[model samples]
Target: MKVDALYREQEQLAKKAVFYDAFGKLDSIAGIDCSYYGDLIIGGAVVIDLNTLEPVEKAHTILKLDFPYIPGLLAYREAKAMISACRKLKSDVDVLMIDGFGTNHPRRCGIATQIGLQLEMPTIGVGKSFLCGNIRDDGYVYQGAERTGKLIYSSRSKKPVYVSPGHRISLDTSVELVEKCMKSDRIPEPTRLAHEYVTGVKNTLK
Candidate 1:
């Protein structure tokens, strides 16, 4: 995949603020996660009803690996399988919460952003570790009081994992959603469940 083209496509989606308004009366959200099998990628997309916090549907798939694991080109390697799994959903998702970055990338495009743009849906990126952003520790309390005026630096490489919009959301909303989805830990519940499902499926296959 041409990096420049992909970047341009996502940038356009980000610029079109109208797309962000599509998220109307969202009742459910889905979380997607993948596990690599040496040469293959097996993944699962789990949809949970926000009101009840129960699993509504799940889609899983295994795809042969084709792209190399480039530092920033992860979407190319995993987008096909992720999209395939998402297509298996029988119900429409109000929002998609992915276990990766969104606009918090070198090209302002990440797996979450790419997938959201392709599907034209609202998506959130919640990374497990730092990818490319900075987190200030200016007496900010963790796992409690919400941090105020915390800005993610997309222009800095050494920055921390940024919480930004993907297709149909705002940066502030994304960060708040992430915080709301957290279940007594740093990782959110949707992504944590996805990680467990993906890893469990991979282990069973092995």
Candidate 2:
């Protein structure tokens, strides 16, 4: 019954997400990721200057795992900590790049979508792996006939990353911005750094 309620909440929030670019300015972007250690989860957010690709601000929050790990309902388990980390950022990022799915999910509401809706901020989801949808010949992922996201290989020798609009952003813009933020790694810098940041925080406990 609780899971059913969560699914309904996702459906409602997904409807509220704007599938177009609704934000002004493109100066900075924040990357959000969460790391785990035992029963603790550490959420990290790192804001980077777009032109320079240098981190301007970063924040993190450590919390106990209050929610169980569910496959399709990750937002319910990790979004609270990620939101706390994002709220701690003093820098006004133009968009958030989260390491999860967005509209690519079965319910069209992934962790990235949930965070963007809850925060009312522009966001993109840069997923390391596919959660749903099948890749068509054009390299775009589709849920049945509707396009969900795109798959692009940041490194030709490595696996591709999935790019999708989370909220207040368009699929084209999401792909463009993620390409700009890409460094030598397959993961975009904002999310890649945030992953490192949170991992480092988790390591300190060991």
Candidate 3:
């Protein structure tokens, strides 16, 4: 999909959609993470059983980061690596949890959205920090209370990360799944584990 077409597609989907509804069936989930070599990208994906939370399969791939770190066009830089890794997975995933924002992006089509849309699978975005949208300290859980259609300003830098719905999931569901996946630390278990594995491999190659 072209970069400019993202917003148009989102607008069309938004008009006819119910933002949140019980999906009713989800047994397996996959997580994706990427590491960069000075700008070159390497991706890792792991599929885990939702009931046992045990890893069933994993895959990794490396791809050149051809695009610059553009604010709204991040999928162009990372999607190829993610897709490559995901294609290698031996098991099918009912849902995907990505280390990014979902429905929390400027374009409303972040990397997680891109992947989910392309693969026609459910996906969620969970970033360590705010991407877009205002996070309310008021303890409200819903998107309206937290904020929407706003950029998530980072403390370290003014440039914000993008978040948005990936596919077959609601923003509220994304948030809930993220909380469930958390294992004490801020990062979720699948993403955290993938990070550890990929970083370990990168370190060994050094």
Candidate 4:
């Protein structure tokens, strides 16, 4: 994919994000994760009921890579497969959690933000490693000089994961929802289920 094209899409995505929802009531949470098998991408989407915190439905898809595995341009490489899997969900996704950065990107339009904007739904980025955000004394995350997201320190986590608003959600609310869905020390339950599903599928195919 062309850098110019991604930039163009990022520009448009930013504009759409301005119209995002930050206070929508959430009932169901959807999480997405992508794994690779050589040159192929396998994506999984899992929808979990917030009240029960158990996966209600799961979907997966495999696709040929269309873009390079660049650090910041992962949305271009992975979003299509994820969207395909997300389409299989029977329940409505009130909030989405993705295995990547949200506003914590160079362009503030990472994969989570891109897909969230595309779906016009509330989304949060749940990254295990630090991407491009700094944590403050009070735990606010800043990218460069502007505040973008926050860090969630799990009792069982060796390192904190970055949490940021992807689309149609506030940074605070993003953290709250992630904490609600978390059943592990490192990752949230919704995303953990999606990751396990994709990992199992990728291993089987390999």
Candidate 5:
């Protein structure tokens, strides 16, 4: 499909996103991330027990890149491998935290939103860099006049990670959960481990 068409699709799907709280107590959380190797995509998922903040289960998947990496339409390129790896997990997690943007995008439909909607699960997005918003003194990220998400400085980092609701989740809860998952790393444990796993797989191939 053309770029314009894909943009339109993102806008349409974003309307289905839910901003209210839709979950009970979160016992476990999973984080997913993808690494690239030429035309291949290596995706990894790590599920951690929320109480101890230790990994309970992990899985990885390697797949071909079907879509080009566009600026805003990242889900088209990476969501496939991410979802595949996530589905490989035997333990069911209460939430899925993905290493990407959620509603904090131009169209409000990011890779995390796409993946959450596809999996019918609650998901949060963690953007390492500022995507498309102005961070206020209160740390709320704003796209134009609408509040999209929040900027949180994790315990071990000078930089802040943007946290946003992907689907079937609220922004406040997204931040709360992400902060709980952070260990001695700037990124949350789930996603941090997932990234490390995928990077290890990529290194092995080289």
Candidate 6:
């Protein structure tokens, strides 16, 4: 098998998408996002101080996408550029918030999970919509028989965000961490900032 093929197989083995039920401090938080311009991908990441919720460092990169876009296999299409951009960060971050699914995916591995596995760091997925699973009556618990994730209605007037553990955390812990990163919106601050940061830099694309 080719090296990339072997790594994909390795990714499959690295994922532990199930709930872990634990919590930890997030002194430094990083968010990741990507945008596309034609056949090019513009990936961005931002790291912020938890106390101030302000970006202390940021990185962005442009790359020609080699993989075709696939629904559940978004990691293969986007993770490389995202990881490259994230690596440009000079400081360490306690957690990474990604704009994709985590365990909410069919294989129990979303883009966030793949990135987390590669980075070997704590990560959380904050998706705008569910790729899989059904929300319970409480609207907080999302489950599909054995697999589960969380949906948070941060504000009554706003729709809930699909939350899942990417790696190094549990469903409950994912929620707790998101709440700490929340400002006045349903979207987590780290991911929100990352999206804005990436989109802004994407203007250079052809």
Candidate 1 minimal-lDDT segment of 10 residues? 140-149
TM-score of each: 0.80, 0.97, 0.77, 0.92, 0.97, 0.87
Clashing pairs in 3: 102-164, 103-163, 103-164, 103-165, 104-163, 104-164, 105-163, 113-166, 132-152
Of candidates 5 and 1, the better by lDDT: 5
Better of 1 and 2 by TM-score: 2
Give one digit per residue, the lDDT tens place, for model 5 in 1-206.
99999999999999998887788888999989999999999999999999998888989999988898789999999999999998899997889999999999999999999999999899999999999988898999999998898988877789988999999999989999888888788898888999999999999989
Which candidate, 2 or 4, has the higher TM-score? 2
Clashing pairs in 4: 21-168
Model 2 agreement with the true structure over 35-83: per-residue lDDT tens digits = 9999999999999999999999989999999999888899888999999
Ranked candidates, highest TM-score first: 5, 2, 4, 6, 1, 3
lDDT of 4 by residue, 45-140 (tens): 999999999889999999999788777888889999998999878788888899998888778888888998788777889988777766789887
User: Where in model 2 is the C-alpha error above 4 Å?
Assistant: none
Give the root-mean-square deviation of each candidate in angstroms. 6.5, 1.0, 5.2, 1.8, 0.9, 3.2
Angstrom error of the Cα, residue 141, model 5: value is 0.3
**Model 4: runs farther than 4 Å from truth?**
19-23
Query: What residue pairs clash in candidate 5, if any at all?
Result: none
Q: Residue 96 error for model 2, in Å?
A: 0.2
Candidates in descending lDDT order: 5, 2, 4, 6, 1, 3
- Candidate 2, residue 71: the lDDT equals 87
lDDT of each: 0.70, 0.91, 0.67, 0.84, 0.92, 0.80
